[model samples]
Target chain A: MRGVVTLHADGLSKDFGERSALRDVSFEVSEGERVAVIGPNGAGKTTLLSLLAGLQRATAGTVSRPPEEIGWVPQQAALYRRLSIRENLRLFARLERVADPDAAVDRALELTGLADRAKDELSTLSGGNQQRVNIAIGLLADPPVLLLDEPSSSLDPRQRAVLWDFIDGLAAGGTAVIFATHEIDEAQRHADRILVLGDGELIFTGTAAELHAAGGDDDLVVAFVRVLEAQGH
Target chain B: MRWLLLKDLQILRRSPLLIGLLVVYPVVISLLIGFALSRGPDKPKIAFVNEVPELQQTINVGGDQIDIASYSDRLFERVDPVPAATREEALQMVEDGEVLGALIIPEDAGRKLQTAVALGGSAEKPTVEVLYDASGPLQGQLVESLVDSTLAEANVAIGERITEVSAGYLNILLDGGSFSLLGQDFDILGLAEAERILGRQAAQLPAGSTERAELERIRRFAELAVENLDFSDEILSSISNPIDVKETPVGSSGGTTLESFAVSASVVFSLMFVCVLLAAGMLALEREEHAYGRLVRGLVSRGKLLAEKVLLAALCALPVGLVMLVVVALLADLDWGRAPLWTVGVLATGLAFGALGVAIGAVAREVRAASLLAFGLSLPIAFLALVPAGTVADPLYEVIRVVSAAFPFKPSLLAMDAALNETGDMWPSVLHLLGLTAAYGVLARVALRRFG
Candidate 1:
């Protein structure tokens, strides 16, 4: 999305006991880049995002980025139901060692369009509002790399649009974003480049037009299915 | 009505654990405790003060009198005789938290036995004084039983001595002392003739018991006791119960029964509410919500995580506890034996219970498990952790007490109990609470490492 890459990964692999979650996946994200890690149910999308966010250590290979430069939203929204939105933001900012937590919290609340509901507890908000609060917490200290694993999995179509538009603004503002999604069309439409993983391996990584041409189809979704079939899925 | 009932069922299914906590827990806990108490008496460690050790002698009792040093030595090991040279020193030991309950043996106790045996039933009855620490209806019973048995054997020895005195004069009485008031041998004398004979003997009988029937009567009275020879019913009553058993619990309060109960309820309930709400409810919720993971990702250290939990728990729990104490103090003439020290104990209770809750959360990783584990542990603690310290002075209880002793509130509550009862050494309780709080904090830290 912008010049000069700020994050780099090479041949990242992870295994949980005997089961391999990710293997030989390499990627690079420049400032303002939006990279979508798209895969099916056990394609290691969440695991790859976790490794990128430094929420986990890779079993082999490496991913390089400043630890403080990354923010993560787990599959589950990491917001305490009892604490107010403002309190949650302030807590995260304080914990993240932000230079001025008060200012950071206020700014995050305003940016997320949750300034009106900042004093309200997360439990009292609508599902979409709660997701916004979760995103605000991740963006509170202004980390450059935002890793969200299936943030819209629970959102409806309208809520998903709201979330993607907000995420789009972050990428436009020069924050590199990596989000995992099972919806192929959404990923094809939103991301600058798609990383398609099949059976824990990165089978393909390219733009929707490049993927369509490679699979010999005009429809990107059909092309994605063709690529997975070719990868022995 | 049907819809309302259906709604209740839905709510119940939604939070089945909450319902179980409110209902099943109490019933199960009551059953466990009832079974344990019914099994047998939990013996206490009674501290006997050997104030006059030289004078405490083993009386020769029964046919096999090869002899033990004293009945004290033959007692259950729980009853330990602490060597206290003086009665004052023994009581001071109790106040200083050195010993539990104690029995004082006088210097002339052994001499009284010797005199009883030599004079046969005509000697002075030796007395024993018992001293008990703070509160223990149970330990008091144990001490009473011990003394009862010891004195019982002594009574047997005195009875044998009296029988020997009776036999010494039985040779003369064997002739049946046939009496005739009118200068004739009347074996079947009427009341008039018997009265006349008694009057004759009374005039001629030297100071006491010269005749055979008179000697027999003396022996009967001597079997009970001999020194105070006034044979009226009132005199016999005094002799029968010689040991007054004046159990003066060092600092007994001069308050209503309700007031005393309020203090105990204050300490125990304060401990329970703070610990359960913080550790089990809040901490487990944090873990379940993945906030702990989120916090760590935000560069929060492990120590800060525990500190935050403790701080939050205290913030929530201490005010309620302090308010409860203030209300009680205002309602009654609550004797804060050592006022500043009592306040310190209350504070320690809050801190320690907060740690206890954290430790529970560390062990139990989910909301249900945390609640069950914390409450399950706390209920037993409230019951077994006797506040007066010596309330359950059984040596056996002491062994398992190590578990409850590790809780800060246990020691803090004990100090409060002791101080209120007017029997305590403040440093011991405070130091114990501090040690346990640190231990609990360390345990929580270790537990969170694996649990997280």
Candidate 2:
């Protein structure tokens, strides 16, 4: 994977009504980098991903990236379920203004191993296949940055491994992947850098080894607890 | 854009429930509306308590009398005239709901008219009182309307009687020179029976009496009046209508009874499109599935997404509109002409509903919400349109009409009315529908873009 800078977020913050969801959150994702936003429920993991995905604008900071170049995969698979997998891919490709929509969809189907089920209604697919189709639609644009929210939340262990492998392949091809997930172990294994947020504040940002070193804990779970404890969460 | 649009079509084709509704409802509901309005209500109930039996006597013209009962008989033809023993009995029947209303004629009505005519037709015309039961307000209003119309006809009848009396007086004075006796029939003389008695009056007068002198004076005056009688075209117009309306109504009476109903029925059918079901649920479905966020971040702009959805819905609505047009025309002998005008109206109507659907999609945020809104929006437009076209011009309907103009269905319905009526000027209505459709489109776009 190429080591080219793709996305830069500085001092990102978000608030909903009187409650703050994120504060002083900043991160840079280079080409081929996989960043995981990990936090307990209501700790602003989804909020941060939403902000980076451009689904929601930050309350107090700037995100610098090429316009219309980010591919976002929502937790529930945001494509139309009534539409066939191929149709969904084709629609997303068209939206991205891909030079050749047919080719883009075909490549996405191949990458996700969804070529056989491309013509099937998304609702008819198993959860694993549907999730793969979701990732495939996100890949249709060949975007430099991809944001996913809980892509494996509904997947079994084997399905989750299969999805992670496909996502890893995309990152290998110079794609910057940022995802939000509740699974701290998965983040430790797959993420190049883990962002641990507690009570709307980013308390730790580093690889699993570095996080363990900083927290004086060997296990990634203990390291996560230590990080949150240090932040007084 | 193509892919996005095709997906909607694909969904429509694949969803059995949706396909069934779109294909079947247009025909079934159109027929239902057509049937419901085609026969409309039964004959309005009326009780006639005609106490003036003496009014049945004939009116005398130059000693020839004509009966007044003949003219009044036509008034009762439009109602289901109920039978009752007396005026009080008729009133009770109305209260009991046996009849909608009653017309109570006074016993002295004939005597008054006769005595008034005897004194040169100068007395005021006797009036008939109307009594009605007010229960079932709508039905009550209907009965009242029927009674009012009947009364108008009766007034015309009275006017004819007065005209006859004056013409009879002229007959007496002219002594049948050119004046025709209104009541007496003569085979060879054309009402010249009055002139045959002229010499008898001369012989009956006493020699050198004052009565003879007065008879001579009247005869001389009558002679001069008959000699100077005007038969020009202007004066002859009284034989026909003195103020002939010349009709020129908005379309050929909107065809026979069935045809007129079609205009309103088709309108109602067209209105049932997306605003009835899909518009209410569209955005709600999107939010429920959480697809809105993905689509916004992906290919299409928010504006484009909304526009595309509206376009799809409008496309779906077109066939339904066409079905309404065809079904109504078939049943009612309705004139569905000015193809260009109808085409534009149908398209705009479809788009407007589509826009409404987009708005619904945004606000409902749930399937049930969509259904409720569709039901909510549909009934009002449909109700306003459900009435017969003839009643639309009634002052009672003015409120509905004004409110209906801002809606897509009403304008399209009215445009079709102009076309069916052959009133020749339908563009104003067409423009109204298009303008409304555009407004709905703009509103839906704004809403979905902001909220979706």
Candidate 3:
């Protein structure tokens, strides 16, 4: 069961010059709810996440969550490669004005299960570990809403499982989770509510069973393709 | 802000190569500038062609003989003057680039000089022709300067000799020989004889006659006028020391001390390499790592982000600048006037350059490109800032002056120079620096927006 709404976007629209990236996208997320923004390439999933994370501004409409109350983890590691994981966390914690940066860094380390590798520089870490540090940076302030853009794009199966488990714990703790992903299986398995976007327009929004029923197909990838085709993408 | 500063410092501390470069850059620049100013230019080899051996002469001035040959010999101290057998040989040597320049004394020069000296007026002055290898312009100019200076000394010696010789002859004539007055030549012996004869005639005329009184008055007047005509000492004194010269400078200090020059050079080097390059490189590094957007999303404001980077650069640069000053002080006599003002100048310089570097890094996509841009910008700015006024042609120097002043380098240098040398007003530089800092700060913020 979903709790009270923690994030709300109403009539969000974004345009890049003459081309529209997102068109009147609307969504709502309640506490502890896991939402997946699944789309084809150039389908405005990242654009929507950026708008919600306050990394970019929407041309129209609004996001109810204040930017300070949001945690944005981009596709790239984006953390300082020369700095250690603890240093990176502490820096972001201080930047976000956390009450206690060291405590926040420690908690982020414990949450990501990267406390043992806290002293290792980002460059020396494996891709998965580096990505954990990236997520750790986003989790420093312990915000109410977390937005991840293709968080597991480059991870192996084992690393992907570990990242999902960590994110699952956060969502279970009432942190509203919104993620953009290309992997259909991960979205169907992990997300409680899935939003399908095709060519900058939201074509479907429901649980996996509802989407499967609507597409007249049991397979999630097949249903996703049918949804995109129906939207003329 | 502290976290932002610490992050950059921690990165720098890990990179030993970067730290080494930061320490080395300013020290090396200071030493190089110190050595360059302390020493004079190398002596250039020149060919000397004396067409007339007769002109190898000497003139007597106040009983001291000054040899014209010795003047050329004195030039050898500043240049390697090789003897060429003929004017053609000297020209060939110059064309072959065997020497920097050639000095040729024409065959008729000796005769012309003699005639001019003897006539005491209205004679064609002898000229010595110089043919320099213009291919190497700087060396050619040095050769010209060395030869010209020697010849000037020789001319002064000759002129004084001529005046002394003329005065000696005048005194001899005024004392006991025939002297000319109002275009009429008169022998003193004849004048004395006439005076004696007239006195006897006047005495034989009458004791109280009008003719006797008139002849006596005329003889007395002539005697007094002859005594006054022998004032040669006054004329000699007037001839020797004509037109006294006293130099007064328009600015505060007599001139910029060598120490002050080195201080300015060291500070400018630190600004370009330590402040500007480091700031640009760090910002570009973030862009390269793709962390710029993350920071933008997390930080309070983009303006604060840029300000931290600028402040980081300046704080890092301060110690490096001081190290450069210490090295300069060791190498030269450094006078750091008023500690507070010097510190302000250095800090302002760092801020101005740091802002500029941030602006550059914001536009550059990566660290290598930012470094290249910094290099391209710094060389010309350093050259323009350090190049002394009047070193080039008037029009080109004016252009450089205006262009350099428009940027922060010259003003930073001027401020530091004023503090070190205690010359010129530093307030103008301070104002200019503040204005530049604000302008570059705005530029960096705007570029970062596009970058983000």
Mind giving the per-residue lDDT tens digits that candidate 1 earns over B1-452? 99999999899777755567667878876765565566434444455655444424544322223232434554444455566767888788766555655667676665665555445435685666777553443334445566567555544444544344343333223323444334565454333334445556556666655474674454444333322322333422223322223455543432213345448556656766675557656778878887776776547766777767776766665566666666777886666555666566666666677778888887776887787777676866676655334433344345436756766645665666555544446567767766766777888899887666
Clashing pairs in 1: B43-B394, B44-B393, B44-B394, B45-B393, B45-B394
* Residue range B102-205, candidate 2, lDDT tens digits: 77766766666555555544455455667665422233455556766666665556556555656645554454433444555553331234333443585588
Highest TM-score against the true fold, candidate: 1
Tell me model 2's lDDT, rounded to 2 decimals. 0.68
The per-model lDDT (C-alpha) reads: 0.68, 0.68, 0.75
Between candidates 2 and 3, the one scoring higher on DockQ is: 3
Runs off by more than 4 Å, candidate 1: A97-106, B1-125, B131-240, B246-269, B315-317, B331-337, B387-399, B415-432
In angstroms, how far off is B343's CA in candidate 2? 0.7
Sort the candidates on lDDT, descending order. 3, 1, 2
What order do you get sorting by DockQ, best first?
A: 3, 2, 1
DockQ of each: 0.39, 0.40, 0.45
Candidate 2 is graded, for docking, as acceptable
Most accurate candidate by lDDT = 3
Candidate 1 chain B weakest lDDT stretch, 10 residues: B60-69
**Poorest lDDT segment (10 consecutive residues) of candidate 2 chain A:** A65-74
User: Which candidate, 1 or 3, would have the higher TM-score against the true structure?
Assistant: 1
